[model samples]
Target: MATSLFKEILFRKKITDDLNVGERKIIIFDEANNGNMGDQAIVYAQTEFIKKNFPTDRILHFSIAESIGILKH
Candidate 1:
């Protein structure tokens, strides 16, 4: 189990290292259009978190009512 976990961590690190901010695209999916404030808040929080952590990566948000849209910084 420990060896498997270590392999997973190393694989993740390799993927992270290969990612380029200019070429990386992150898509966040949510059900915010169902009139749920909590869902909206979660999406908002996630967007903020991603922006904070991956400052240069492109972020896309998709909700139930709308199609794919790019997140503005």
Candidate 2:
């Protein structure tokens, strides 16, 4: 839906709006959920991939609910 897409954009903007220019950071979204094993494995693989490829940049985690909550403003 358009509203969902709009909320996603707003939430992403909210999370990154305060960052400085040329920030070297990677955000892993929805990895903080209490999901099943498949989801956990996906998160683990993503983390390992980022760690292997981008050893210097900082990593950040955010949940889907948390992202949508930011759009409630």
Candidate 3:
């Protein structure tokens, strides 16, 4: 459902192309598989909701399970 919605947004071109050249290179991470506390749940939903809006080749889809970042004290 999320993927479909994103596709719709992209198809309609409703989203603003405000990204810069450097920003475009960044991949939006859904973080569903991640265990970090700082990760925004809404953003995850939004990410999942709008994933298909972007090109598959250019975007890197990552789930919470795939994230393995370690925080140091």
Candidate 4:
């Protein structure tokens, strides 16, 4: 678990360095994909809003659950 967390952290930094996340970084700290329609819609809407409003900004989504998507997928 600790290793996974560490890798996730490193990957985040690497992505920032690689993609050059500028002043506007939209970070969704804790995301859930537990098949909840409301939750999914919230995330979707949040992302869409960001994309429409902050077109040039970057989005970093972190999942605080048993299955972390960034590393797994």
Candidate 5:
């Protein structure tokens, strides 16, 4: 079965001249085919694509139980 993959990236925003900062989390979700065959490989490939396209400070991943359509804004 296919699952929706979620990647959240956190970035530090400088708030003060003395190095104080705040962290912001940006969430991105992508739906992919993850049937009984080649699910892991597909997921890995998708991850690499995201990493190359949207390099960030940190990344967090999760799987959604349901499939979803992707949209860009």
Candidate 6:
């Protein structure tokens, strides 16, 4: 299971690396603002991490539990 998971990660990394940043669209689905402090913090951290790593890519986030959509730069 661990080996498969590692391979999946590497495959995803390769796919992401091959994509053009200018045309890439990243969608983040999380349980955001659902009255769970931990979930909220996780979502916030994920958003910041993505923004920091992919500064030029378009990022869209949606609350999987609440259907709240957020478009972030």
User: Which stretches of candidate 1 lie above 4 Å from their native place?
Assistant: 1-22, 65-73
Model 1 residue 11 distance off true place after TM-score fit, in angstroms? 33
The residue-level lDDT of candidate 2 at 55 comes to: 96
Provide the clashing-pair count of each candidate structure.
Answer: 0, 0, 5, 0, 0, 0
Q: Give candidate 3 misplaced runs (Cα > 4 Å).
A: 1-24, 33-57, 69-73
Evaluated at residue 64, the lDDT of candidate 1 is 51
lDDT of 3 by residue, 16-65 (tens): 35433354533454345445545667556656655557444244444443
Per-prediction RMSD in angstroms? 12.0, 6.0, 13.3, 5.9, 10.5, 10.8
| lDDT tens digits, residue span 2-65, model 5 | 2122111112222123322354323434434456457667677767877777676333343442
Overall local distance difference test of candidate 2: 0.70
- Indicate which candidate wins on lDDT: 2
Whole-model lDDT per candidate: 0.59, 0.70, 0.45, 0.69, 0.40, 0.60
How high is the lDDT of residue 18 in model 1? 40
Cα lDDT over the full model 1: 0.59
TM-score for each of the candidates? 0.51, 0.60, 0.25, 0.60, 0.36, 0.53
Error of 4 at 16 (Å): 4.6
Q: Which ten residues in a row have the lowest lDDT in candidate 3?
A: 64-73
lDDT of 1 at 39: 80
Which residue pairs clash within candidate 4?
none
What tens digits encode model 6's per-residue C-alpha lDDT throughout 6-68?
Answer: 334435446445343468777775546678898888988888998999998776554564232
Candidate 1 lDDT over 1-73, as tens digits, reads: 5545433443543544444346876776543766678887888888899999999877755565333221221
- Model 2 ranges with Cα > 4 A deviation: 1-23, 71-73
Q: What is the lDDT of residue 6 in candidate 2?
A: 47
